[model samples]
Target: MFEQAEAIAREMKISRSAVVAIALEEFIRRRIGIVPLGEKSNGKIVVASTDN
Candidate 1:
C-alpha cells in the first residue's frame, strides 16, 4: 500500500506525505458528514439538504 501510494504521489507531482494527509483529511470529513464550504451556491443564501 505504501509503494502504491508513493507511485500515486509521484504521478500527481506531490509529496507522499501530502497525498496521505489529503486522503486522511477527506476520509475523516466524509465519515463525519462534513461538506466543503462554497461547494454549492447560486449567489444567494439558500437552505439545502445534503441528505442525498
Candidate 2:
C-alpha cells in the first residue's frame, strides 16, 4: 500500500503522511462511524452498531 500512497501523494502534491491522514479520517468517519469533522468527541470509545 505504500506504493499506492506514494503515487497518490505525488498526484495530490501532498506528503505521504498527509495522504494517510486523510484516508484514515475518511475511514473513521465512514466505516467506524466516528463523529464528523466539526463536532466534539465525548472522550469515549465508539463502536459502530452491528445490528441492522
Candidate 3:
C-alpha cells in the first residue's frame, strides 16, 4: 500500500498526504452520500472499496 501510494504521488507530483486526502474525500463523497465531510459516524469502521 505504501509503495502504491508512493507511485501515485510520484506520478501525480503530489504529497503523500494529498494522495490520502484525495482518497478520503472521494470515499466520503461516495459512501456517505448525504452526510458531509468531518461528520461524526456511528463508531463503525466501514470498508471502503478499492475498485478504481
Candidate 4:
C-alpha cells in the first residue's frame, strides 16, 4: 500500500507518516461510532464521526 499511500501524500504534499496517522485515527474514530469524512482505499482517507 506504500505506492497508493505515497501517491496521496505526494499529491497532498504531506508526509507518508502523517497520512497513515490520519487513516488510523479515522479507523479508531469509526470504531468509536464516529463518522469520518474522506475517501478510503488500501491507503486512502476514511470518513468517521467524532462524537463520543
Candidate 5:
C-alpha cells in the first residue's frame, strides 16, 4: 500500500502527505455515509452530503 501511494503521489506531482490527506478524507466520508454530489475525475472532488 505504501509503495502504491508513493507511486501515485509521484504521478500526481503531490507530496505523500497530500495523498494521505485525500485518502483519509475519502475514508471519513464513506464511514459517515457522506456521498459525493457528482462523479470524481481528474483528481477533483465534488460536493459532499449525508443524503445518500
Candidate 6:
C-alpha cells in the first residue's frame, strides 16, 4: 500500500501526505454510502473488505 501511495504521489505531483489524506477522505465517504467528491483520476483502484 505504501508503494502504491508513493507511486500515486509521484504521478500526481503531490505530497505523500496529501495523497493519503485524499484517499482517507474518499474511503470515509464510501463507508457511509456517500459518493466521494474527490477529483476523478484516471485508472481504477479496487479495495475489498476483510476481517482482521
User: What is candidate 5's TM-score against the reference?
Assistant: 0.67
| Pairs in clash, predicted candidate 1 | none
Q: How close is candidate 6 to the true structure, as a TM-score?
A: 0.64
Question: Candidate 4, residues 1-52: lDDT per residue as tens digits?
Answer: 9999999999999999999998997799679765567756457676454544
Candidates ranked by TM-score: 4, 5, 6, 1, 3, 2
lDDT of each: 0.73, 0.77, 0.75, 0.80, 0.78, 0.74
- Per-residue lDDT tens digits for candidate 1, residues 1-52, read 9999999999999999998987886587668876533344456543454543
* Model 5, runs deviating above 4 Å: 37-52
Q: Answer with 2 or 6, whichever has the higher TM-score.
A: 6
Off by over 4 Å in 1: 35-52
Clash pairs (backbone) in predicted model 2:
none
Better of 1 and 5 by lDDT: 5
Candidate 5 global CA lDDT score: 0.78
Off by over 4 Å in 6: 38-52
Could you tell me how far off, in angstroms, the CA of residue 33 lies in candidate 1 after the best superposition? 0.7
Better of 1 and 2 by lDDT: 2
Tens digits of lDDT, candidate 5, 1-52:
9999999999999999999998887788779776544657456766654542
- Candidate 3: regions farther than 4 A off: 34-52
lDDT of 3 by residue, 11-52 (tens): 999999999998887687768673334454586445553544
